[model samples]
Every structure is written in structure tokens, then in C-alpha cells.
Target: MRKMARHKDVSPEHLPYRRCVGVVLLNAENLVFVGSRTEGPEHTDSARPWQMPQGGIDDGEEPYPAALRELYEETNVRSVELLAEARDWFTYDLPPELVGHAWKGKYRGQTQKWFALRFTGTDSEIDIHHPAGGAHPPEFKAWRWERLERLPELIVPFKRAVYHRVVQEFAHLVG
Candidate 1:
């Protein structure tokens, strides 16, 4: 069984979940895109600190467009074909330490709508630095292609369960 982080604080229960979108971007070689997040105010204690592209949805934004916008915002890649979407939204709680720090204490965690997208462009089109003309500082400092099944281990422990479910949901579509 998966051991998930237990939130011991009662206050977090009263906080709502942040609505977000997660992208599993696959290249033609069947590898998934994983980014090494930069150390920041919202940084977790994960040793690897790697994750797929993800971000919160704007007000009145639909999930599909939100997913695309996040992917482009984080990866600077716009040439992608929609492959699949998770059957249901998945949620993960912030560790107790992060409950009040991350996302400005706006939510307990995130409720994400996951999408699997196929990269339709060449590697030259991928750029993490200066994403959105550096309008948004890069979330990731470095990135690489990785196996889909390895994501759970590569991500922050608190979010591993969601990553596992996403891999299970989209594994068949990749090599």
C-alpha cells in the first residue's frame, strides 16, 4: 500500500483545494518530460524535486485550456497533441509544514485535472528558461526526458500518489 503523508492539523481541513492542471508530456521516443524545480519559497524537502508541468487554473478557465496554458508557461512548448485525460480529478495534501506557506495558505492542497499530451515538435522547441519571454520566472532550472513509470519516485513524496495514478491512467498510451 502507498504510504501517504498524514496531515495532523485540523485547520487544513477547512481550507479548500486549489483547482489545477497537470500535464504528462510525452515525446515520440516514449519518454516523459520531467523538470527539476528551482529552490523557492514553496520548495519541499524532496531530494530530487522533479515534476511534470503543472499550475493552477485561472478563474473561468476550463481544464483543457488550462492544461495547455500551463504546459506552455512551464515548458515553452506549444506543439502538442492531446492524447488522453484522467477519468477523474486527483487530490494531494500539502505536508503539515507547507499547509500555511505554499500557495499563500489559500488551500489545503491541489485538486488536479491531469492530461497526457504528445509532443509534436522537435527538441529545439523545448525551453524552460525564459518561458513566456521570462514574464514568468522559470519554475524549473533543468529538465530531461524520463520513463513514465519512474515519475512517482522522482516527484515529491506528498504528490507521489497522484503521480502514480496518472502513470497508471496514461501508461498504455506511451511506449
Candidate 2:
């Protein structure tokens, strides 16, 4: 098996089957936080190429905690309450090239546990520095709050399905 990255130091099986968590943070303006990948080559034909703050769940960590952790790590935003979590996990496979060399043979892709949160604070709460706790820094140099329904049109194609589910689950928050 290939060794994973420095983010977590646990055996493969102990992890949640490529498990990850993400937060769809909703602000009072009804816009959701969306960010783009800063490091990878841009997709040529993607409809929307941004992604929400998300990351893998560490061994023995619950999905909720992971979701909160990922949100803080990816966006530097914190202190939001977890309002709800998907009853089931939403999964997506990484294109072969997206997988790191260490995870190539042993893992198929990622299985994400998604959550929805309401921002109790202001924009000053977001801290892009050391997002992902230094594991994965901000990919996009910029971020903005946008209508949640419009996200699927702005995210990478591979993530559009999950974005759809997010919108459906949080449709009540849409203006």
C-alpha cells in the first residue's frame, strides 16, 4: 500500500473508507462559502470549478468533528454550529491523476460526510491562513459568498453531484 500524505498518520483501514467531511456554511445574506483549488491545473471543460471547505476524517474522529475541523482548516472560519449532517455519506471518486502517488493502488477515491452550518458570526471570522491546519492550504487565492443553487454551475464537474445534494438538503436556506 502507498503511504498517504502528512495530514493524518494512521493505517488505511483505520480511516473511514476514504471518508471525508465538508461544511456548507450559510450566512445571513443567504450566500454560501465557495472556494477554488489553488494548486492543481485548471479543468478545461468544467462548468463550475470551485469547491467547498472539505477534508478527510482522521482515524477515530467522528464525522461531525471532522466537518468542523475541515471547515476551519480550509477557510479559517470557525465558531459556527453544526445544524445538520447528511443521513448518509456522499461519495465521489477522484480522477486517477488527482490521487496522490501514495494512494494510487490502495484507494479508489474519497467518501465524504457532508454537513450544513449557519454562520453565527461575521466575515471577519474567516481566516484563510493555515486553512486545513496546514495540511491543505487555500487552493483558491480568493473566495466569495454566492447563491447556493448557483454553486453547481461554478464547481468542478466531479463535484457537481455532491453540490446538487447539498443544495437539495439546504434548499430551505436558499432565498
Candidate 3:
């Protein structure tokens, strides 16, 4: 453990990526779920702050369950069925400005397991105003269903590459 701690403090590049799960919720209309972030005061100049539902992977939790839990926690929408899973996990790095500030400075970025889900319920089921599935407040201030191809353009810049990969990997399922 001492050796690991020493390596951990070595440098930012040596820091591990946070384990996470990301989901793309698709409706019959083939639209992807997107939510506008409730940005902090410091992010007033952020350009694209929208993102899909996502969250950390709790210890002992598998990616699929984590994905479902995160989706519900962030959106309060449970009427979904797994449509597909990505062939591989995707990762993204936080910019230098965010590296030691995100996740309470525990991680350099995130290594994510991505899932695609199909919504089986009505729009009224989504309650972004007050998420019932989580102990905390909703992560999103507003929500919308958007074109799958536009995902790469909707998220924060650092996350765009992963979105592009997801869009490409799940292209066949979208339409």
C-alpha cells in the first residue's frame, strides 16, 4: 500500500482514472437523451455543457447495474431496457484545469463503461426537476431527446471524443 501511495503521488499522469459508467438512452424516435448541466458559478463561460446520464461505479457494483442506477439517479426515468453495450470501455481525460479539481481530486479523468438503453415509457415518466432515484439533487437542470449523431457536439469539449466513439459504435442501433 505504501508503494502504491508513492506511485499515486508521483505525477498527474500516474494518477488512475476514476471508474465510471455512461449511458445513451434512445427512444423509438431514435433520439438520444441529453441533459443540460447545472454548472457551478465558475463555469459561467462553459460553451457546451450538455451530457448523457453518467456516474461513478460504486465498489462491488458491475457496469450494467451502475449504468441503470446512474440513469435513474440522474433522470428519474426507469422505464428502459438494455439495447446494447459498447464493445469496449471508453476513457477521457479532464483538462489540466480540471485534473486535480474533479472527483475531489481523486482522479485524473474517467474510464467508462458505456451502455445503450431503449426507453419503454412515456415522456411524463422523466422527472429532471427532482430526481427520485438519488439521495442527492438531480445532476441535470433540464433534459431533452436529441439526434444520436449530434452527441459529439453536445457534450463538454473534453468528452467529445468519447461521444464520437459512442455514436459510431451505436450507429446501427440509432436508426
Candidate 4:
């Protein structure tokens, strides 16, 4: 049997999964939104550090509202219409190297409720450089619309599984 990794004198398995939300923001072309992460340990993947906008659910916030909040906070996108929610929450574990170093060692991984939203505004409204500013810093250095099926290929390897599931869950909605 494999042994559980320990961090801060505690086993990683003992830590709780953080509750979070992910958004698949699609434009009129049916392409999905992806952002290149501001270089960091988690963003070192060779394929591309790109990922959809995502964030933790604040205490007392519902998943849907949290999804909407996270999208706008990261992308400065507000003209979106709800399309569909994933049939189930998806999750992924941090790779061993990131086990306790990511997210300030607060979570073993994240259990995310994913949302699919259609962009109702033009591409000019998108801005990764100046996302809703306040407490949140810019998470992305650049952004683009990508084919929906290619999302899993562009995300960090540790997060590919969840992105695969999201693609499968929302594939039918794409053109």
C-alpha cells in the first residue's frame, strides 16, 4: 500500500478538499475561454499553463453564485448567460510535488462545481490584465478563446482530469 504524504506534521489525506467553482465561458463561436496562468509552480506544465477561471467558494456562498463571481473576478466578463451546470462535481488531487505547497497547504485538492456560461458580449469586453480588482490579483497574463475539446490539453497536468471531465460534460453544447 502507498503511504500518505505528510505536511505540517499531518497526513495530506487528513486535510479537507477545498470547495470551489470552475467556469467554462463560451463565446458566440462556441469556443471556450482559457488563460495562461501568471507563472508559478502550478503553472509550470510544458503543454501550457492555461486554464478556465476558477476560485474557492466563500463561506455561505452557493455554488452557482460562486461560479458567477469567480468568472467575473478573473476575466472581467459580465455579459454571460447561464447555459448548463455539470451533472456532478469533479475533483483532482494535487501532484505529489504540490501536495502541501499549493493553496498555502490548506487543501489536499479541490472539489469543484463547474458551470458552463455563454458569453453574450463581444471579445473586446474580455480583459485578463485588469480583472475585477480589489482583493484578487490578476491570475492570468494573457487569454484566448479555444476549441472546447482542446481544454484538457492546455491546462496544467495536475488539473487535466477535471478539465477532461468538464469537456465531456459540456461537449454537446459546443458547436
Candidate 5:
């Protein structure tokens, strides 16, 4: 017989997932928005830190607005038009090493609703150095437009599943 044991004090299954919203901003060239995460645990992987803009869902917020809010908050992009929403919510778990450490120990990982939007403005409008009227620090140091299919390769492994699903769901809309 085999047995699986879990920590009683903080079992992985008992931890709540963070509710988050993800944004996939697409430009006229059919490129998707991606950014390099500027924050995480000191020893976190730097190689695959690039990701789409995402953030926690505030209390009493709807997913669509949250997605747009996160987009503006992270990338200073507000000239976008709603394109599509993912068919369903997606989730991923952080490695045990990250639990109790990431997000101030508030979540095991994130359950996210992703939104796709078309950029109706120019590249010069993007300012990762300043976001949401400068009310919050930027989450990314650099940003770029990439093919939608490349997202899984750029994101951290823990969140790759969601990115892969996003790519699959949005692939038909890509050029």
C-alpha cells in the first residue's frame, strides 16, 4: 500500500486559490502583449519570468472589468477594445516551496479568468514605468508584443498550463 501525507497545518488542498484576471492584449499586427515580471521570491526563476499582465481580483469586482483594470494598471494601456473572453476560468498551483511565501501566504496559486483585447492605440502609449495613474508600482520592467503561440514559452512553468490554454482558446483569432 502507498500513502500520501500532507501537512496538517497548511495542507495544499486546504489553501485557497487567489482570484485573478489575466489580459492578452493584441495589436493590429496580431501580436500579443507580454512582459517580464519584476517581482517574486529572490531565488525565483528568471529565465521564464515573462508573462501577460495579470493581477488579483478585487472584492466585488467582475472579471471583465478586472481584466481591463489589470491591463491599464500594469501596462498603462486603456485604448483597447474587447475581443473575446476565455471559455472558462483556469487555475494552477505554485510549487510547495512557494506556498506561504507568495502573495503573502494568502493563496496557493491563482484561479484566473483571461480576457483578450485589441490595442487601438500606438506603441508609444505603453508605459510600463507608470501604471494606473501611478497609483501602483509597475509589475513589469519590459514589455513587448509576441505571437499568441509563444506565450507558453515565456511564462513561468507554474502558470504555463493557463497560458497554454489561453493560446489554444485564442489561437483561431491570431493571424
Candidate 6:
């Protein structure tokens, strides 16, 4: 079974099953941040699709904090002013291959808690290598701001459906 973190203030029953979190960062131009994954040897020369920053929640971590952490780790962007957060969690099942070996039996996939944040800081604030903290060393090699409505078409296939839903739910912020 996948070990999921539960908040101290909330009971497990109240939390979404297999919870994760994602950050949707919007700039003043109303463009959303999108990133290209570093090309692997197997995918060399192939265009890597873009995605918003996201990741799993750690034990005892809340969704919003996880979202902020992922944003910094993935894009080197921070100081986000949160605009909104989903009232309910969105879920998608991971393909079997994507599941960890120990979690295959209990989990069908992941349930994600999402947040929308406006970038209040200048572009200079984005540092893919700030020493304060972040997730991985940065899996993304390149990034740019794109129209929110077009994100569903630009992201990887696995994330397309959720991106579509997120766009719809947060369309008000885009305009």
C-alpha cells in the first residue's frame, strides 16, 4: 500500500485517498508557467511535453505546502500569492508501471489536491538553483509562460485530462 500522509488537524477519513498536490503559477500577462522535462537518452532529439509543477505529499504535509514546495523545486519560482484552491480533490489512476512495487496491491492511482497561485515577484526571483530548498535537482531543462486555455494541448498525455479539469475550474482566474 502507498503510505499517505495525514494532517494532524484532520482525520484520514476526511482526507482524499492517495493525495498529491500541484501548483498552477500565473504571471501578470495571464500566462501560465509550463516546463519541459530534461530529455533522457531514450528520448534524445524528441520533444518533451510540458507540465506544471507537482508532486506527492509527504507524511504530515498539507496540500498547499506541498504545492508551494513543488513549484520551487520544479520551476525555481517562489513567493507565490495563492489565488485559490480546489474545494475538492481531483483523482487519476496511474498506469500500473508507474506505481511503486510495494504500492501495486492497494492503490489504483493518485488523488491530487490542486492550488492556483499568482506570481507576485519579478522574473528575476525565479532561480532554478536557490539554496534555500526545493524538491529534486530539477527535472525540467526549459520553461516558458503559455496561455492557460492551451495547456491541455501542451502537456503530456497522462496529465491532459486533469489539466483540462483544472483549466475549467480555474478559468475565472485566467481572464
List ranges where model 2 is wrong by over 4 Å: 1-17, 41-47, 96-105, 130-136
Clashing pairs in 2: 38-139, 48-154, 48-155, 48-156, 49-154, 49-155, 73-131, 73-132, 74-132, 76-127
Candidate 1 per-residue lDDT over residues 1-175, each given as its tens digit: 2243334444798999999999999999889999999976446654868999999999999999999999888888999999999999999998877776677767889999999999999988888998865677899989999999999999888899999999999989875
Position 1, candidate 4: lDDT: 20
Of candidate 3, the 10-residue stretch with the lowest lDDT total is: 1-10
Q: Give one digit per residue, the lDDT tens place, for model 5 in 1-175.
A: 1222333336567889999999889999999989888865522667887889888899999999899889889888999999999989999997777766667666788899988899999998898998877877988898888989988988778788888999998888885
RMSDs, each prediction?
4.3, 5.9, 5.7, 3.7, 4.9, 7.7
Candidate number that wins on TM-score, 3 or 5: 5
Clash counts per candidate, in order, are: 0, 10, 0, 0, 0, 0
Write down the RMSD of candidate 1 (Cα, Å). 4.3
lDDT of 4 by residue, 1-175 (tens): 2334445544578878899999999988999999988965466564577899998999999999999899888888889999999989898887766666677778888999999999999888777788875446788888888999998888877888999899999999994
Task: State the lDDT of candidate 2 residue by residue for 38-105, as single tens digits.
Answer: 64432433335577787778889998888887787778777687677787777765544444432433
Off by over 4 Å in 1: 1-10
Greater lDDT among 2 and 3 belongs to: 3
For residue 34, what is the lDDT in candidate 4?
91
Question: What's the CA error at residue 33 for candidate 2, in Å?
Answer: 0.3
For candidate 5, give the lDDT of residue 75: 88
User: Lowest summed-lDDT stretch of 10 residues in model 5?
Assistant: 1-10
lDDT of 3 by residue, 83-144 (tens): 99999989998776655555666787889989999999999989887786446686788889
- What value of lDDT does candidate 5 attain over all alpha carbons? 0.84
Give the least accurate 10-residue stretch of model 4, judged by summed lDDT: 1-10
Runs in model 5 with CA error above 4 Å?
A: 1-9
lDDT of each: 0.88, 0.70, 0.82, 0.85, 0.84, 0.70
* Model 6: lDDT to the true structure: 0.70
> Can you give the lDDT of residue 82 in candidate 4?
96
Runs in model 3 lying further than 4 Å from the true structure:
1-10, 40-45
All candidates' TM-scores?
0.92, 0.77, 0.89, 0.91, 0.92, 0.76
3 versus 5: better lDDT goes to: 5
